[model samples]
Every structure is written in C-alpha cells, then in structure tokens.
Target: MKRPKFFYLIAGFFILAIFLAGCAGQKGNEQGKSAGHPNVLKANWQDVLSQAKGQTVNIYLYGGSESTNNYIDNWVAPRLKKQFGVQLNRVPVNDTKDIINKLVSEKQAGKKDGSIDVMWINGENFLMSKKNNLLWDSFSPKLPNVKKYVNQNSPAIKNDFGEPTQGVEAPWSQAQFVFTYDSNKVKHPPKSAEALKQWVKQHPGKFTYPAPPDFTGSAFIRNMLYETTGGYKQYLKPLDKQTGLDNIVKALWNYLNAIEPYLWRKGETYPESASKLDQLYASGAVWLTMGYDPAHAANEVKDGRFPKSTRTFVLKDGTLSNTSYLSIPFNSPHKAAAMVAINFMLSPKAQIAKSDPENWGALMAIDPNKLSSKGQKQLNAIDRGKATLPSKVLANHRVPEIPAGYVDYLEKGWMEHVAKH
Candidate 1:
C-alpha cells in the first residue's frame, strides 16, 4: 500500500500548500485585528449604535468658557441623547492636565474601568497622554465618519504639534492664534514681530502676554521665537532637549530680555492666564489681548465683554494654527458609547451646528469638499459675526505650530531668563 515516489511528492506539495494558506489566513486576521480591535471596530455602523444604546459617556473638557459649556450642554448633549440613546455627561475640568493626572493615577492603580470616557486634548497634553499609554489604542480610524470625511494626509490631521497622532485622537475643531485690540485704541495695529516690539516700545505699559504654560501665552512666545529664528523651519524636527534649549532657544531668551523692560508693568509680572490677559484688555489696563480661538473677540464683543470696536488680527508673517482633538482614556468604562459620540461629533450636522457664532464658533474640522451639498450649504450659511476675521484671511495668515517638546523648553527658559531676570 506504499505509494510511488511521484505520488508521495504530489501529496507533500498539497499538504505544504494547505499549511501555507492557513498561515496566510491567520496572518491576515492578525493584521485586521491590529488595524483596530473588534470591540470598537464593529461589523457594521449599526452594531456600534446598538451596543452604545443606554450608555452614559463622561466627556472631560476644559470648561473655562461659559459659551462652550452651554453649547455642549444645550446642543451636543441633547442631540446625542435623541439620536444615539447615549447620555452625554459633561465633566468640566479646569485644565486637561487634571484629566491626564487622573488617568495616570488610575493606570498606576491598575484600574480596568476608568471614569473618563472622552477628553478634549491636543498638543503637549496629547503627547503626554500618548507617551504615558493613557489613551485608547487607535480607535479613531474605526469611525466611519472619520474614514469618509477627514483628510488623513493633511498635517493638521496627521500631526499634533509635530508628534504623530497615530489615530488615537479624533480632531474636534480648528483654531488659529489671533491678537485682539480696540480699533479706536490701536489705529494701526502691529502686523509683524518687529512691529509688535516697536509698538510695545512706543506704547509702554499697553501690551503684555500671559505667562508661559498657559496655552495662549505659550503660543505667543513660540510665535516670537519663530519670527526671530528666521521662520519655524529649523525647529520642526524632534527636539534634542538640552541642545535645542542651548542652541535655538538662547535667541528667544535674548529677544524677550530686550523687550522685557518695555513690557507692561515693566515686565515685573505677567498675567497668569489668557482670561486674566483678556480682563486687562477689557478694563483698559492693556491694549492687546490674544488667544488661540479667533472667534473669541467676536463672542466677547457680542456679550459686551469687549468693546464694540474690538477686532481680531494675525501677524503678517502668519500665526500658528492647530486642530484640537478628542481622545478616549485607556481604561474607559464605556468605549462603545464614546466611539458613537465621537463619530456623531465628526458628522456634518454637528460640525455645521458648532460653526454658528452663537454656539461655539470653532472652525469646522471636516473638509467642506467632502461634505454633501446640503452640508456645504448649512456650513456656508453660518454668519461669521462682524468681529470675526474672514476665513480666507485666517487661512492666508496661518502658520504651523512648532513641536510639542519645544513648549516645555520655551516655558522653562522664559521662567529662568525672562521671568526671573
């Protein structure tokens, strides 16, 4: 019953082919799983919605702005509840770092089910969370809306302050740095860093920025650094902490030092936060107030927090622009609900609603070209209030943010060289 050598060889070949085919199938499954875990990556969109029903997702965000809080509470919350059967619980944190700290603590304690489901995060905070393994693993790519509407190749989508997002965070909104001033007070506003410095010298006690570590203040410093260092080209790569501080940041310190004596309060102290800086501008203590939110001045004008003549402007050399993102904590108790909510937020309907000046006034993160005709019309219909600069203006003057590591170096250098000096 022994087979001939040719028959034996043929049988061996068939067995080897089957084994290799089995191995390939297994490898393909592994690759599929690696793309996104099955728990968050459902077989269909309906499956995600079905599992998300009746779940309460807690979203932790910076609740500094009453308008932002109201928008979430009044608009987004109700929509999620009605459409997805998910209760959106808005957990207001004074700073995103508070949430990151809590997540770190939970991770250290080996907690499987953490309280925070979704968080508003970007830049240094996002880098920290991702580095510390505090964020969920690549769930953003699983969302249908993101896959369809988001331009994944765009730098704003791919990178957060020069650090790769790796699909862990979902972009929520766009912001650009802008300075606000009363048109009556500053007849000819400074249009570049050199002009701003000269303006400060000419109008001493009239201009100041928030101390570093505050997002807006940090941005102002970065802009100055870019201006002095011949435009942000040299600082785009991953930072070599001490080398960058010594070689690149020395110029920044020198620039700040030269301007220190002419700064408000003779550079004796800086406003603690952007809100405090805004207060100074409102009370006529300072002529210049700046923020990452370009629409903020418009909102302030409407609310009568700022004068009717208050207007927003960017530097001629362009100002930093970035997209803020939402991410899930690593140990979220309700992953499905969080995914459903984030997907909904990325929808054209939600983006249009958020673009309204009365609501949040954040720029749409979704590309208009990808949107349907109805969606495009709704987005276009939003009246970008009188105080808000035109979209084309912002776009023309937009600049990229330097890497996140540079932030800490700049802040520390400011404290040592400028604040202490």
Candidate 2:
C-alpha cells in the first residue's frame, strides 16, 4: 500500500541516521586500535625507537635511598638521554602506594593520557597494580636484553611474592633477606630463627625489626614464619581469609609473642621504618638490624653510617629472595620511551655498573651465564665489598616468598597478637 509523502520522508531520515551511527561506531573502534592497548605496541622496534625520540619518560620510585636516586639520576638518566634522545625525569615518591592511588584516580576519571611512564615496584604493590588493571602487560619478553639474559624460568623472575608476574613487569634487580650486625659487638650472630630468639633473650634491647607493612619489616616477619613453620611450601598457593588467618599464620603469631618481651623498648615500641631501624643500629642503640637488600650493609658502611666492621649474614635454613621490577602504567603517555628506558636498564653495562658496591650495590637481574665472556668478566670484576655476603652464600641460602594475599593478613596478625598483646 502506498503511504503519504510525509511518511516516506520520515522513513528515509531514520535509515540515514542508523547508517551514520554505524559508521561512527566503526570509527571509534579504529581509533581505539590506533591508540594502542597495554603492552601491545603496534609499532616495530625501529618504529618504537623513532616514536620514542625526544619523548620524556617519568619514572616514579621510592626515594628512601640517596645512592639509588643518584645511580638513576647520574648514571642511568645520562645514558638514556645520550643514547636514545629521551629525557629521563625521576619522580621520587615516599611510597609506591602514592603512585598506585594516583593511577587509580586517573583511571576512574577516564583520563586517557597518564603522567607516570614507569614505576619501580614489586611484591604486594605489583600484585595490587596487576589485579586492579593498572599495569601494562607482557612487554618484558620483547626487550632484547631480557630475552637474551634473563632466566625466564627462575622463580625469582616468574613470580613476585608468589604472585605470577606474567610479563606485566620487567625485572630490575634481585634482593635477599639479610641480618646486619657490628662484628665488634656481635662476636657470633644468630644462625637461625630459633637461635635468634635466644640471642634476643640474652641481649635484650639490642635487636628489633621495623614495624610490619614497612617492606623490610614485612620480609623479616615472613622469614621468621618460614623458620617457625617447616617451610614456605604450604604457602605456594593463593590464600583466602579463613585459611590464611586461621591455619597458615597462627604459628607466626606465637613466635612473635614469645620474643616480644625481648624486643627493643621491652616490646612497647618499634622502629617505624627500616631506615629508622638502621638509625638505631648506626647509633649503637641496637646491635643488629635487617633488610631485604644483601648489599645494604655494605652501602651503609661505605656511606660512613654503619661501622666499618658491619657484616651481613643469612640464616642457615635460608632467606627470602625475590626480583623487583619496573612496570609501565596502563595509561602511560610514552610507552615506547618507557620500554626503551627499561630495556637499557637490563643491558649488561647497566647491570654491571649497578652491581658495583660504589654505585647502587644491587644484584643484577640479568644472568651472568647468559652473557658474553667479556660481560661475565666485567661482572666478576665488580667488588661486592667486605661487608657484603658472597653471591654463592646468598644463592645457597635463598628462599621463596609467600603469596601476596598472606602479607596483609600476617601484618594485621602481628599487630593483634604480638604488638597489642
């Protein structure tokens, strides 16, 4: 049946509107493709290098250590700028949470371009960022240095505190738990967690840990848990509220409670952070301190903060060891430049320079076995310092980290069962 002209005109208008809307949606999808997804750079290596030229990559990292800051600012930054024509802006953050919070806020606001290009992170922070979809993905495998030198199968490389890294972050350096003591004061240091308790009892007010939630303190607690329990094997899987709190962490609380009265300040107070605990050790107020970095004692001694006789040791059973990583934010504005910077960091030259005790004193994430003979020789030439424990000793006594979920539960339990009690 033939309709009126007005009806036919309205029908034609509707058809055109529908077609336009479809075209607009297609365009939007195409735009999204061009913008690039996380870790999926649409460009090849040369293209990426070209795109990164003249770009500035802002790196956010914990600013607790002057030496680390100096290494990046003086050595890394200069090399990046000279070689890649990229500007390196090191943004010092008191804590990594500040960076995460900012990223979350930016995501909530739908900000497409973010300020943070790269971040130095690991452990629970890495887990949190990955879980929240705040990090880019799977880019480390593409980096030439990582592909050639990194031991991809190593647990230290594959996991961050038992949370699978999944290539979301590129390993920056390795760390292991170590106790530092003034050799003049401690003729013989505790060789195990059990011995540590007796030592604490015998020399009251001479030892203490930084409060939990501080990175080093949390590690110290986990190390204790491993020693108290049979091993860290049971904590290999993901944890839940019930099992994590009730079964897994119960023994840790008991141990802490038993040793609490012997802690510095008679268990009434504790150092707020690792640096504070270091201060106590430096001032001769405490005989022993602890940290995740094996070379930290050496670095402190070099800085004249720690006594020249300061020495580091790991427990007989083992000490926790893990790799820290540098990750890009999901909304990073300069993905290529960030990748360039991270790739440079993984290079043999950078790793060797970073491992020097005079510089950062960080363990290289790159495997020496994978490097050329010259590179191996260079790594061997770096002095690990008198205070630093030998790499072979560290490797022999290395332990794996527990899952990230268990961390907060343990920290809270410490407060409830040991701190408050």
Candidate number of the best TM-score: 2
Give the lowest summed-lDDT range of ten residues in model 1. 31-40
Candidate 1 lDDT over residue span 1-421, tens digit each:
8779999899999999999999999987764333233455545778778878888999999999877887899999999999999999999999989999999999999886778989999999998998899987788889988998999899988999999999999998999999999998999999987898899999999999999888889999999988887898777877874454476667778888888888889988999999999999999999999999988998898889999989889899999999999998888877888999999999988888888878988888888899999888888778878778998899999999988987898898888888888
Minimal lDDT window, size 10, model 2: 31-40
Off by over 4 Å in 2: 1-40, 241-248
lDDT of each: 0.88, 0.88
Tens digits of lDDT, candidate 2, 1-421? 9889999899999999999999999987665443333334656777778777788999999999887998999999999999999999999999989999999999999887888999999888898898889997688888888889899998889988888888989999998899999999999999888899999999998988998888888889999989987888877878862463466567878888888888899878989999999999999999999998888899889889999999999999999998899999988878888999999999999999999977799999999899899988988888888999989999999988888888898899888888888
* Model 2 / residue 357 / CA error / Å: 1.5
Name the lDDT value of residue 160 in candidate 1.
96
Show where candidate 1 strays beyond 4 Å: 1-38, 241-245
